[model samples]
Target: MNREPLSTKEKLLDVAEELFASRGVEATLVGDIVQGAGQRNPSALRYHFGSRDGVLQAILEKHLTRIEERRAKLLASWPAPGPRTPRDAIELAVVPLAELLSTEAGRRYLRILGQTMYELAPDQMKGVGKYPSLSATIDLMRGCIDTLPPRVVDERIQGTLLLISAMLAIRARDMSSRRRPPLPLSTFQRNLIAMATSTLTAPHDEP
Candidate 1:
């Protein structure tokens, strides 16, 4: 069956995602995206998305909405009181995000997310009211690690997010480039979840 052609707006988004992922977002120019999308009009990006930031937001919303839905389902399917261990909560957090690796567009979004995540403030990373599923996952993970002081828990949570994004971004890049991923996909995912679980559950040392 023939695939449907992408609309002009989708074309722009596709090009923008690639450019933003390969080049740092700040380094990718608006004109580059416009030209890459084969849009003759210089204003096409502006017409579809108000500005560079708007384009970035659209890209994030497009991918994250799907991720949020998947996470919500996982959370709902849990047996009663929720995740029983640090690893269980970590699996909830990592699995939905890792599923993105199954598709090319999803992989590109992962790369883009990795680029942008470090720049976000702590509150922004939590996504707070905007992403209830993500917030709930964070809360669930926090409960599993409640032995730590509040500040330490927050730091580990942030670290876990950063680690997920960075590692998945590298995996995405490998898949995109056709490089041999050191481990098979199943092994990679299991190990990634294990590493993240360790980060969250590691014992805290006194300052």
Candidate 2:
């Protein structure tokens, strides 16, 4: 069977995604990525992606573009003054990624995304600003949370995003491993929607 070869840029992205997911991004080196991609040139990473951060951002953009498209379509169908249910808003944000998890690459990418969400340094965080789609979805979630009082929305929004990232990462890892007491993807999505809904809508006391 003949398989078309990956381009130099894609080879790097593929190798980097796996390494970044299995080993933390900071722990993985440009040398490691190029070597894993079957390239001998240390300069290949720099030539293709400029630097480690550039590679990571490119990988993120690749996936976010697709995920954001899904979110946009979902948002379009959802009525304006949107997301009457907590589940509605949360699903708009995450269900696309869950659908992506049906593929091997999606699982790998999710692991890297989880690491980025939880582990990146403050300076590294700036790269996230490059993705408008991601920002739009986040703003949508904030608007969804507006059903709550302004005080609660202010207090809980950041934590809600963090929790969503962490939980989805955990689920992505679990999905990749094919663990015993197996969690079906549908079940995982259902539970996540429930948890996210509760977290966003949960009552808060003013300080």
Question: TM-score, each model?
Answer: 0.92, 0.83
Cand. 1 TM to true fold? 0.92
Local accuracy of candidate 1 as per-residue lDDT tens digits, 83-181: 388888788888998999999989999999889878766566555668888888788788888888887888888888889889999999999889999
Question: lDDT of each structure?
Answer: 0.88, 0.76
Candidate 2 per-residue lDDT over residues 107-164, each given as its tens digit: 8888787777655443333344555556666556667767677555655655565677
Task: Give the winner by lDDT.
Answer: 1
Worst 10 residues of 2 by lDDT: 119-128
lDDT of 1 at 36: 99
Choose the strongest candidate by TM-score. Answer: 1
Residue 34, candidate 1: C-alpha displacement in angstroms: 0.8
Error of 1 at 164 (Å): 0.8
Predictions: Cα RMSD each: 1.7, 3.3
